[model samples]
Target: MKFTLVIRQGKTQLIGQLKEIPGVLTQGLTIAEVKENIQDALALYLEDMREDDAEDSNAIIAQEEVEFA
Candidate 1:
Protein backbone atom coordinates (compact mmCIF):
# COMPACT_ATOMS: atom_id res chain seq x y z
CA MET A 1 0.00 0.00 0.00
CA LYS A 2 1.10 3.53 -0.73
CA PHE A 3 0.92 6.24 1.90
CA THR A 4 1.47 9.96 1.74
CA LEU A 5 4.72 10.78 3.49
CA VAL A 6 4.97 14.18 5.14
CA ILE A 7 8.43 15.40 6.09
CA ARG A 8 9.34 18.23 8.42
CA GLN A 9 12.71 19.69 9.26
CA GLY A 10 13.19 19.44 12.97
CA LYS A 11 15.74 21.21 15.17
CA THR A 12 18.41 18.57 14.61
CA GLN A 13 16.81 15.90 12.49
CA LEU A 14 14.21 15.25 9.84
CA ILE A 15 10.76 14.19 10.97
CA GLY A 16 8.62 11.97 8.78
CA GLN A 17 5.02 10.90 9.15
CA LEU A 18 2.32 9.02 7.28
CA LYS A 19 -0.21 11.68 6.44
CA GLU A 20 -3.02 9.15 6.18
CA ILE A 21 -2.38 7.79 9.66
CA PRO A 22 -1.96 9.77 12.85
CA GLY A 23 0.62 8.72 15.49
CA VAL A 24 2.58 6.93 12.79
CA LEU A 25 5.61 9.18 12.87
CA THR A 26 9.37 8.94 13.09
CA GLN A 27 12.62 10.94 12.80
CA GLY A 28 16.01 10.48 11.27
CA LEU A 29 19.09 12.50 10.38
CA THR A 30 18.50 11.96 6.63
CA ILE A 31 15.47 11.76 4.40
CA ALA A 32 16.47 8.25 3.38
CA GLU A 33 16.50 7.12 6.97
CA VAL A 34 13.24 8.90 7.65
CA LYS A 35 11.59 7.11 4.75
CA GLU A 36 12.82 3.78 6.03
CA ASN A 37 11.59 4.56 9.53
CA ILE A 38 8.19 5.60 8.23
CA GLN A 39 7.82 2.31 6.40
CA ASP A 40 8.70 0.33 9.51
CA ALA A 41 6.38 2.41 11.67
CA LEU A 42 3.51 1.95 9.23
CA ALA A 43 4.12 -1.78 9.10
CA LEU A 44 4.09 -2.09 12.86
CA TYR A 45 0.99 0.06 13.11
CA LEU A 46 -0.85 -2.15 10.60
CA GLU A 47 0.25 -5.29 12.43
CA ASP A 48 -1.06 -3.93 15.70
CA MET A 49 -4.35 -3.00 14.05
CA ARG A 50 -4.68 -6.50 12.62
CA GLU A 51 -4.08 -8.02 16.02
CA ASP A 52 -6.67 -5.75 17.56
CA ASP A 53 -9.18 -6.72 14.92
CA ALA A 54 -8.51 -10.38 15.53
CA GLU A 55 -9.09 -9.94 19.25
CA ASP A 56 -12.42 -8.22 18.63
CA SER A 57 -13.55 -10.50 15.81
CA ASN A 58 -15.35 -12.87 18.15
CA ALA A 59 -17.06 -10.22 20.24
CA ILE A 60 -20.83 -9.86 20.06
CA ILE A 61 -21.33 -6.19 19.25
CA ALA A 62 -24.52 -4.17 19.23
CA GLN A 63 -25.32 -0.64 18.17
CA GLU A 64 -28.22 1.69 18.95
CA GLU A 65 -29.12 5.23 18.13
CA VAL A 66 -30.39 7.79 20.63
CA GLU A 67 -32.34 10.94 19.97
CA PHE A 68 -31.64 14.16 21.84
CA ALA A 69 -33.61 17.34 21.97
Candidate 2:
Protein backbone atom coordinates (compact mmCIF):
# COMPACT_ATOMS: atom_id res chain seq x y z
CA MET A 1 0.00 0.00 0.00
CA LYS A 2 1.23 3.46 -0.88
CA PHE A 3 0.83 6.45 1.42
CA THR A 4 1.84 10.05 1.43
CA LEU A 5 4.96 10.63 3.46
CA VAL A 6 6.24 13.95 4.74
CA ILE A 7 9.97 14.09 5.37
CA ARG A 8 12.08 16.63 7.19
CA GLN A 9 15.81 16.82 7.82
CA GLY A 10 17.20 17.72 11.21
CA LYS A 11 20.68 18.83 12.20
CA THR A 12 21.93 15.26 12.46
CA GLN A 13 19.08 13.11 11.21
CA LEU A 14 16.15 12.79 8.87
CA ILE A 15 12.54 12.48 10.00
CA GLY A 16 9.37 11.27 8.31
CA GLN A 17 5.66 11.16 9.08
CA LEU A 18 2.72 9.54 7.34
CA LYS A 19 -0.01 11.95 6.41
CA GLU A 20 -2.67 9.25 6.32
CA ILE A 21 -1.70 7.55 9.59
CA PRO A 22 -2.07 9.75 12.62
CA GLY A 23 0.75 9.65 15.21
CA VAL A 24 2.96 7.48 12.95
CA LEU A 25 6.45 8.90 12.57
CA THR A 26 10.15 8.00 12.52
CA GLN A 27 13.66 9.31 12.03
CA GLY A 28 16.84 8.11 10.36
CA LEU A 29 20.26 9.24 9.15
CA THR A 30 19.35 10.03 5.53
CA ILE A 31 16.35 10.60 3.27
CA ALA A 32 16.50 7.05 1.93
CA GLU A 33 16.98 5.76 5.46
CA VAL A 34 14.08 7.81 6.74
CA LYS A 35 11.89 6.50 3.94
CA GLU A 36 12.58 2.91 4.92
CA ASN A 37 12.13 3.65 8.61
CA ILE A 38 8.86 5.43 7.97
CA GLN A 39 7.62 2.52 5.88
CA ASP A 40 8.30 0.11 8.73
CA ALA A 41 6.75 2.44 11.29
CA LEU A 42 3.64 2.79 9.12
CA ALA A 43 3.31 -0.97 8.84
CA LEU A 44 3.52 -1.36 12.60
CA TYR A 45 1.06 1.46 13.13
CA LEU A 46 -1.46 -0.10 10.73
CA GLU A 47 -1.04 -3.46 12.38
CA ASP A 48 -1.67 -1.91 15.77
CA MET A 49 -4.74 -0.18 14.43
CA ARG A 50 -6.05 -3.47 13.07
CA GLU A 51 -5.27 -5.34 16.29
CA ASP A 52 -7.03 -2.73 18.37
CA ASP A 53 -10.81 -2.75 18.78
CA ALA A 54 -11.20 0.52 16.99
CA GLU A 55 -13.78 0.66 14.24
CA ASP A 56 -13.30 1.77 10.65
CA SER A 57 -10.16 -0.22 10.09
CA ASN A 58 -11.01 -0.19 6.39
CA ALA A 59 -11.38 3.55 6.26
CA ILE A 60 -9.86 5.15 3.22
CA ILE A 61 -6.56 6.95 3.58
CA ALA A 62 -6.45 10.56 2.41
CA GLN A 63 -3.89 12.36 0.30
CA GLU A 64 -3.20 16.05 -0.24
CA GLU A 65 -2.90 17.52 -3.71
CA VAL A 66 -0.57 20.40 -4.42
CA GLU A 67 -1.66 23.34 -6.54
CA PHE A 68 0.10 26.47 -7.66
CA ALA A 69 -1.69 29.76 -7.50
Candidate 3:
Protein backbone atom coordinates (compact mmCIF):
# COMPACT_ATOMS: atom_id res chain seq x y z
CA MET A 1 0.00 0.00 0.00
CA LYS A 2 1.21 3.50 -0.81
CA PHE A 3 0.48 6.79 0.93
CA THR A 4 1.06 10.40 -0.04
CA LEU A 5 3.40 12.51 2.02
CA VAL A 6 2.81 16.20 2.42
CA ILE A 7 6.08 17.70 3.59
CA ARG A 8 6.78 21.23 4.62
CA GLN A 9 10.20 22.80 5.01
CA GLY A 10 10.58 24.31 8.42
CA LYS A 11 13.33 26.49 9.75
CA THR A 12 14.82 23.75 11.89
CA GLN A 13 13.41 20.58 10.31
CA LEU A 14 11.14 19.03 7.76
CA ILE A 15 7.60 18.33 8.84
CA GLY A 16 5.55 15.68 7.10
CA GLN A 17 2.12 14.09 7.25
CA LEU A 18 0.40 11.25 5.47
CA LYS A 19 -2.30 12.62 3.21
CA GLU A 20 -4.57 9.58 3.43
CA ILE A 21 -4.25 8.95 7.16
CA PRO A 22 -5.09 11.65 9.65
CA GLY A 23 -2.88 12.36 12.68
CA VAL A 24 0.08 10.54 11.12
CA LEU A 25 2.75 13.20 11.19
CA THR A 26 6.42 13.53 12.01
CA GLN A 27 9.42 15.87 11.87
CA GLY A 28 13.01 15.25 10.95
CA LEU A 29 16.23 17.10 10.23
CA THR A 30 16.39 15.85 6.63
CA ILE A 31 14.12 14.44 3.92
CA ALA A 32 15.58 10.98 4.33
CA GLU A 33 14.86 10.99 8.05
CA VAL A 34 11.38 12.35 7.46
CA LYS A 35 10.67 9.53 4.99
CA GLU A 36 11.77 6.94 7.52
CA ASN A 37 9.76 8.59 10.26
CA ILE A 38 6.71 8.68 7.97
CA GLN A 39 6.96 4.94 7.46
CA ASP A 40 7.08 4.43 11.23
CA ALA A 41 4.19 6.81 11.69
CA LEU A 42 2.12 4.97 9.10
CA ALA A 43 2.78 1.65 10.77
CA LEU A 44 1.85 3.01 14.15
CA TYR A 45 -1.25 4.63 12.70
CA LEU A 46 -2.55 1.35 11.23
CA GLU A 47 -1.67 -0.54 14.38
CA ASP A 48 -3.58 2.00 16.42
CA MET A 49 -6.57 1.67 14.11
CA ARG A 50 -6.54 -2.09 14.58
CA GLU A 51 -6.38 -1.64 18.35
CA ASP A 52 -9.25 0.81 18.25
CA ASP A 53 -11.33 -1.62 16.21
CA ALA A 54 -10.63 -4.36 18.72
CA GLU A 55 -11.81 -2.08 21.52
CA ASP A 56 -15.04 -1.05 19.78
CA SER A 57 -18.20 -2.75 21.07
CA ASN A 58 -19.95 -2.63 17.70
CA ALA A 59 -17.06 -4.02 15.66
CA ILE A 60 -17.96 -6.89 13.37
CA ILE A 61 -15.54 -9.76 13.15
CA ALA A 62 -17.32 -11.90 10.60
CA GLN A 63 -20.64 -12.65 8.98
CA GLU A 64 -22.11 -15.69 7.30
CA GLU A 65 -24.79 -15.72 4.66
CA VAL A 66 -26.62 -18.26 2.52
CA GLU A 67 -26.54 -17.85 -1.25
CA PHE A 68 -29.82 -18.06 -3.07
CA ALA A 69 -30.32 -18.24 -6.80
Candidate 4:
Protein backbone atom coordinates (compact mmCIF):
# COMPACT_ATOMS: atom_id res chain seq x y z
CA MET A 1 0.00 0.00 0.00
CA LYS A 2 3.02 2.24 0.29
CA PHE A 3 4.53 3.88 -2.77
CA THR A 4 7.33 6.32 -3.45
CA LEU A 5 6.02 9.79 -4.31
CA VAL A 6 8.14 12.01 -6.49
CA ILE A 7 7.25 15.70 -6.46
CA ARG A 8 8.54 18.46 -8.67
CA GLN A 9 7.59 22.01 -9.53
CA GLY A 10 6.37 22.39 -13.05
CA LYS A 11 6.39 25.65 -14.99
CA THR A 12 3.30 26.90 -13.24
CA GLN A 13 2.29 24.19 -10.79
CA LEU A 14 3.45 21.43 -8.50
CA ILE A 15 3.59 17.99 -10.11
CA GLY A 16 3.65 14.63 -8.42
CA GLN A 17 3.83 11.01 -9.43
CA LEU A 18 4.01 7.55 -7.90
CA LYS A 19 7.35 6.07 -8.89
CA GLU A 20 6.14 2.54 -8.17
CA ILE A 21 3.11 2.88 -10.40
CA PRO A 22 3.79 3.77 -13.98
CA GLY A 23 1.56 6.43 -15.58
CA VAL A 24 0.15 7.52 -12.23
CA LEU A 25 0.70 11.27 -11.95
CA THR A 26 -1.01 14.41 -10.74
CA GLN A 27 -0.45 18.13 -10.49
CA GLY A 28 -1.48 20.98 -8.23
CA LEU A 29 -0.66 24.53 -7.26
CA THR A 30 1.35 23.63 -4.16
CA ILE A 31 3.39 20.79 -2.71
CA ALA A 32 0.81 19.98 -0.08
CA GLU A 33 -1.94 20.14 -2.66
CA VAL A 34 0.02 17.95 -5.03
CA LYS A 35 0.61 15.39 -2.31
CA GLU A 36 -3.05 15.30 -1.45
CA ASN A 37 -4.04 15.05 -5.09
CA ILE A 38 -1.62 12.19 -5.70
CA GLN A 39 -2.96 10.38 -2.68
CA ASP A 40 -6.50 10.66 -3.97
CA ALA A 41 -5.43 9.53 -7.41
CA LEU A 42 -3.63 6.52 -5.99
CA ALA A 43 -6.65 5.57 -3.93
CA LEU A 44 -8.93 5.77 -6.94
CA TYR A 45 -6.49 3.79 -9.06
CA LEU A 46 -6.32 1.00 -6.49
CA GLU A 47 -10.08 1.01 -6.12
CA ASP A 48 -10.55 0.64 -9.85
CA MET A 49 -7.98 -2.13 -10.01
CA ARG A 50 -9.75 -4.00 -7.25
CA GLU A 51 -13.14 -3.49 -8.87
CA ASP A 52 -11.79 -4.90 -12.10
CA ASP A 53 -9.97 -7.72 -10.34
CA ALA A 54 -6.63 -6.66 -11.71
CA GLU A 55 -3.51 -8.19 -10.26
CA ASP A 56 -0.93 -5.83 -8.84
CA SER A 57 2.59 -7.09 -9.33
CA ASN A 58 4.05 -4.33 -7.18
CA ALA A 59 1.67 -4.28 -4.28
CA ILE A 60 4.33 -4.72 -1.63
CA ILE A 61 6.97 -2.09 -0.97
CA ALA A 62 10.58 -3.01 -0.25
CA GLN A 63 13.91 -1.33 0.26
CA GLU A 64 17.58 -2.43 0.23
CA GLU A 65 20.74 -0.93 1.56
CA VAL A 66 24.35 -1.27 0.45
CA GLU A 67 27.61 -1.03 2.40
CA PHE A 68 30.74 0.62 1.09
CA ALA A 69 34.04 -1.06 1.62
Off by over 4 Å in 1: 60-69
RMSD of 4: 8.3
Superposing every Cα of model 1 onto the true structure, what RMSD results? 8.2
Pull out the clashing pairs in model 4. Answer: none
lDDT of each: 0.86, 0.79, 0.86, 0.81
Point out the higher-scoring one by TM-score: 2 or 3: 3
**Regions of model 3 farther than 4 Å from truth:** 61-69
> Which consecutive 10 residues in model 3 have the weakest lDDT in total?
60-69
Which structure is stronger by lDDT: 1 or 2? 1
lDDT of 4 by residue, 1-69 (tens): 467899988999988999989678999998889888998898898788666653553654653555545
Per-residue C-alpha lDDT of model 2 across residues 1-69, encoded as one tens digit per residue: 567888887777887888877589999988888888987897798688667734654664753556655
TM per prediction: 0.76, 0.65, 0.76, 0.65
Q: What is the lDDT for 42 in model 1?
A: 86
Q: After aligning candidate 4 to the native by TM-score, how far in Å is the CA of 12 from where it should be?
A: 2.1
* RMSD score of candidate 3 (Å): 6.8
